[model samples]
Target chain A: MASVVPRKSHNLRYKTLMAWLFTLPGLVVQLVFGWLPVLFAFVVAFQRYYFIKDPEYVGVNNFKEVVADPLVITAFQNTLWFAFLSVGLTFLMPIFVSILLMEMSRRTIRVMMILWFIPVASTAGIAIWKYMYHPNLGLLNGILRGLHLPEQKWLDDPVLAMFSLILPGIILFGPGLIYIAALQNVPEELYEAAELEGASFWRKIWNITLPRLRPIIAMMLLFSVIGSMQVFELPFIMTGGGPGYATTTVVMYIYSLAFGAYNLGKATALAIVLFCAIMIMVGFQRRYFPENIDESSENARS
Target chain B: MPLIPQVGRRRPKTRLMLLAIAIFLWIGVLLHLFPVAWMISASFKPTLEIFNAPFRLIPKEPSAASYKLLASTVNANGQSLNVDVFRYPLHIYLQNSIKISFLTLLCQLPITAMAAYAVSKLHSRRAAKWLFYFFMGTLMIPGQIAIVPRFLLLSHFPWPTRTVPGIPFTDLFFPSWSFIGTYWGIVLPAAFSAFNFLLFKGFFDTLPTELIEAARIDGASELTTLRAIMLPLARPVIAVTGYFTFTGAWNDFLGPWIILMSEQQKWPLSVALYKLQWALTSWQPSQGAMDPALQTLISSGVGYNALMALAVVESIPIFIAFLIFREQLMKGIQIAGLKG
Candidate 1:
């Protein structure tokens, strides 16, 4: 019996060691690339770092410089405008689209989904939009000219550029995969009950569908806000933050500061500020629009 | 009073609603696909025909001039346009993208799956809880915060600066090695994704422990069991995760844009396309006055046609990947959305 106990302990130790061996590589990668850089971002935010020289700890000077930079304000305003407009314009699209799609035949739905989500590379999508937005030679202008309408500078006009950046998303809207999945989870009994009550289609959607979709809507809202706030590639590719800083987002500003100007410290400082803002927004969202529906019902059922 | 509406009235209204919905959705789909179709059509048009009036959706005279330009460096005038800016051919950028994406997959899949398996099945309850948190805690923090620091770290590896702890002077500090201007810089940081780790762990949790225990009793090692038993059952998860990872890495722009900026030959198609667009568009007549070749190229509209061709090239692989993994990709999204 004593010998068997020792052997069991030996086996346990070997198992633990094996577990650690499996975990170590992933842990090392996460530490070096994920956690360490995040920690280093805090440190870099307080220091002045030019690649040519050793970093000098400036103690809030980078933050001060970030504040002083006139472009910072413009970037923030543009980002906020983008986030608000994107949410207002496109957030509920997938939910409504999914509801409409639920009425479609299965074959039709599949065909529509394939057409809608064609897997165009994001940069390629941006390039396509950039060409379409061209003033003189673009297809949009060509169509306008054919219609005998005056051609407008789509991207070069400061007022229209930000709107133009998001225009493609609005036009290409479809049911998000998430929303469809959520819609599928809406109990058939609920719809049957509504049908028995003679509730109209719109009423059923408003009363049952929207309420059930609230949790997903809230979650997607948060994602959209985060995504739009960090808008970089579209504006960067389409306008180069051009038409005189009209479309320069906070992220694009940080990118230019880091790479274009080699002002690493200031860029990190701005990034940290953006991080804090995003965290606060997330916190507010969690408090107000809690994702408590799934868990509570799941626990009740289980 | 009747509890339900009369079938006679309800039938037509429902059919009308269904018809309206179908019409609306079909229009939406057509509008959604318009840009992609336009891109393909524009790619086939000659530079002059692209700009010509009447605005045909189908090109009047479809030509391979733009594609031929991308395939080779020399234009019809026998002048080297160097559209990619670094003078490397289009295939070189494609090769770099493929190499980096494949390396990322090679490193990411096994490392992530192993860690997920350990957390999901091998670890003790308390230990698993802690390890899962450790891996997933990074998800709460936005990735942009790490961008600058990561760039700096890649530029001067092991140490972000020329300073080491316990060393008296800054001069004594030296980086172990730099990953800048290399594929490792892009591939290393992407080797373990917290989101994918969660997906893997969730999938693995659904696997029965008795199977693994049976393998153990049959004298199979943990690695052997994972390989010979768990992997066969994990084909769907593997396919979904692999597709996401490959497409993500393939389409990543900023990472390659920053890390491989100086090494233009190593730039991916995304960065190369960006540079090409910038160079072509930023070419002012005043700037090109000294170079007749530049003026001729600008006036010919070849740059615009070539840009469209590049866009087509960039989108083809992702389209093919989607087609191949269509079911798995949709299932993955459905699972992720429901779980979230």
Candidate 2:
């Protein structure tokens, strides 16, 4: 037994060494680019960073400023509003559409899902939608004219710009594919048994599918919050955070602070705040709706 | 009664109803595709026809002139709306984009695959789990948080293959291969995709253990076992990853915008398009009398056409790649389930 123990210990040591070696590159990268920057940003949030010079420490002053500043306060309010509304819309639209898509055969369902999934990948779809929302030459304006309805400036109107952003926000909900896959996995026998017991279609869906999908839906809701919160490119191209800051996301604001104003300190401060908000949101999600969803486990095989 | 009727009266009625739903779905799909159709139409029409009220679905006349002009036009005003001589040629930016995307694919795939294999094939579960947790935790850190630091890190670079006298090659090799305003900028930032690593690792994890055992028993090294046994099995995942990396690097505007700031000579197509945003408004009144605003409007159409044309051109390769890899892409996405 002692002899066996030594051999086992030796092998375990060797394997551990190899494992560390294998993991070193990713760990180093995560530390340098992914982890350290976050820590640095956090530190800088309390300090001040000036371009072409060293940072000077200032204890909690930046946070005080961030909280007290009217712009920051407004940004926080606007961000929360956008997040809640977009997250609600993105989450619900997919489940609703998936149910509608579910009323067809598996073949048709697959085609529709693919069509929906394509936009999640291709920026072309977003570009196309931007052109469609153009105030003068865009299709939406054309349609409004044809119908003799009011033509909106769309992205150019402060009141309407955020709403304009919402159109793509609604059209581009891709949670449907994941939802469909999850829906398909619910054992048919359960549904058949429900039907045999005289449960109506709506009742079967409510009881069987919704309960089964709680974990996935929870994760999707988290995804929607994180995604809409950090969104930059869409508004960057479509509105440039105008008509007058209505569409400026927190990320865009940070980018402008960092590059445009060259105020790395304020940018880092904003970034840390954004990061904390995300962490808090994620923490809330994990607390409220925890899952043993090894989401990546499904990534290995189709 | 038959448990599952195959073409009885009730089944047919149900099938007919489903078919009706399917046809209705086709209409919904068409409505979804409406914007894309409109974009194509706008790209083809002349300036006068584009803004004509009650915008015509069918153009009065369509022309390929916009596409042709964009493809060939070298010197055009960039994104600035109020500046002349602020323009750079699209071809240079396009070339830069293509160069960077290709290299990004080249560097990212092998590095990620090697790292993935290492993670999956490692003998210790504790180490593997830690690596995974570390990688996955990166997902929660909003990338915006890292942007400032990363930009700072990139600025202190001495790029494109330099040598230091004493040290091992990698450190010196690295700063020389620095990631600011160059192709390496795009490639390096993107190289460590934790999600891709997970995808690759997941695929490697599912491989038959016996094959690795046999290879090791035959005295093959760990790297050799990976090369011989694991890689061939992971071709589908790798191909999908490659396609994904290509598309992402091709379309990304943020990295370039942050890191590459020397305008005119140093920009990608996306940056060029962004710079060209107000290029139309900057047109000077041809040193003669005419409503310069009217002239500006006409020129603005040309610029607008150019921008849309760029969007179309950028999208074609991706759309074609989609058609080619439809099955694989679908299969890959279904598995990966989108981490970002």
Candidate 3:
């Protein structure tokens, strides 16, 4: 036993050295690109970065400028509005679609996902929608005309532009692959027992399905909230923050502030503000939801 | 097989509800597929007929003219007349897209996998927990926060400052390498995804430690154990992560847009598609004269058709990838380990 102690310690020491060696490459990369830049965000937010000049400390001036700009207010309002609309309009559509898809056989679910998940490049999708939203020649107006309904300025109007950005999401709604996975992970016995208790279809779904899906739904909600708050590409590509500040999200504002205006400091400051906003939402989600639900639920699976 | 068991189908009311559900799903599917269908239709149609009265799902002309415009190898003979040269001649950008996506996978998979494996197996438990956090801490932060800093970092490598600081007590400066305007700019930052690290780690943790113990007893090094035994068993995780990495890299716009924007030759399909769409939409026929680039597209017998054709071209690889990885992903996030 005494001899075994030293040998075991020696083996552990050797393994630890090998482990560090294996981790070296990833450490260097994660440090350089991952860790440093995250810390650097705060540093840049407080400094003035010029194109060809050295960065100078300008304590809180960038944040002050962000607060002073009226357009920044508009961008934040639009971002919040976009987030609100995304949650109300698009968030539950996946769950709803999955529930609807759940009524079908497993084979149908597989086939539908195969077709549904074949997504276009996001830019391409945006471009397609942009064309379809064209007031004069777009298909949406044409469909409106064909139906004898009033043709509206789909994207040209400030009121409708945000809606138009969300229109594709509503139209392209389908079951999320993750939601389907979560649904499948539910044990067959739960439903079998529910059915034996004379539970109706809707009863089974409400009692068995949704509760089982709660963790995934909770996590997805947090992700969706974070994602919609930082909505950049959709508005950037579709409207170009167009028809006034209607679709200019906060992240889009940061983009223009950084690249278009070449004011990196202010952009980083706005980005940090956006980060705080997302973190607050995430914090709320963590507080409300059991984040380690899957771990608990794993014992229930086959 | 589903929430509604097969035996329930015999009940009259249940059959009706199921029928209604099926109809609802089918309608959703059609609405989802309409844009893709229209994209294909417009790509094959003549420009006038695209917006013509009585909208058609199938093109009347059904010509390959727009595809020809995209596939054209012809240059602005000798003088390089067209200024918006990146607008057409699609193969170069297609190749660039493939290069960026593949190169990103090449760098990302091994690096991220090795780190995840080390955390899962080789490291002491206490150290592994901290190391896991070191790699994964980035996942919680909104990625937009670091965009400005990342750009600055890349523009002057190894320095977050655009201007490098001098070495203390010496006239010499720290060595640096700029990745801006090069493929490395995109590849280097994307090489270690904390998300993939999470996936790989979860997978490794699931495997019995006894396998590693056996390998070690046989005098295998940690690297060899990973390569010889662990990796072969990790095929499902690799498939899921690799497919994700490939698709993420392919669909990416902002990274390439920021890094390789100025270098036209380095533009991937995402950037090129954005440029093409911007050029296509910037002009209106009702407004008389047009940009020379628009005129070149017009002379070639298409307008927005080129953009549609390009969209189809861009989506092909993703669709092919979906086909190849269809089973792995559709096995659901259960197998993908995305659930946790």
Each prediction's whole-model lDDT (CA) = 0.83, 0.67, 0.84
Can you tell me which runs of candidate 1 are displaced by over 4 Å? Answer: A1-4, A294-302, B1-10, B82-86, B162-175, B284-293, B299-301
What are the candidates' interface root-mean-square deviations?
A: 3.9, 4.8, 1.8
lDDT of 2 by residue, A31-92 (tens): 66667666667666766776756678888777776667676765666677777777766668
Q: Residue A195's C-alpha lDDT in candidate 2? A: 65
Worst 10 residues of 1 chain B by lDDT: B1-10
Could you tell me the lDDT of residue A136 within candidate 1? 72
| Winner by TM-score between candidate 2 and candidate 1 | 1
Q: What is the DockQ for all candidates, taken in turn?
A: 0.55, 0.36, 0.65
Residue lDDT tens for model 3, B208-266: 99999999999998878999999999887888899899989998998998898789988
Using lDDT, rank the candidates from best to worst: 3, 1, 2
Per-model TM against the reference: 0.93, 0.85, 0.94
Ranking under TM-score, best-scoring first?
Answer: 3, 1, 2
Model 2 lDDT tens row, B1-340: 1112233326776668656656766766776666566666666777666555326666678876667656543224433323321344456777777877788788777767776777777746776677778777888667878787777666643311112233575445332334666666666667678767878887887777788778866978677777788878777787788887888887888887777776446676666666554454223345366445435435645645555676666666666666777777666655555331
lDDT of 1 by residue, A1-302 (tens): 88999989988998999999999999999999989999999999998887778889999999999889889999999999999888899888888898888777668878888788888877888888888887776878878888999888888889998899888878887888878878878887787788878887789887778778878887788888888888788888889998889999999999999888989899999999998888888899888777777664566579
Local error of candidate 1 at residue A232 (angstroms): 1.2
Task: Give one digit per residue, the lDDT tens place, for model 3 in A1-302.
Answer: 89999999999899889899878888999999988998999999999876766789999999999999999999999999999998889998899888789778778876777777777877888888988988776888888988999998987799999999888888888988777767777889998998889998789877788877887788788888888998888888888898788999998889888888899999999999889988988888788666575654664574
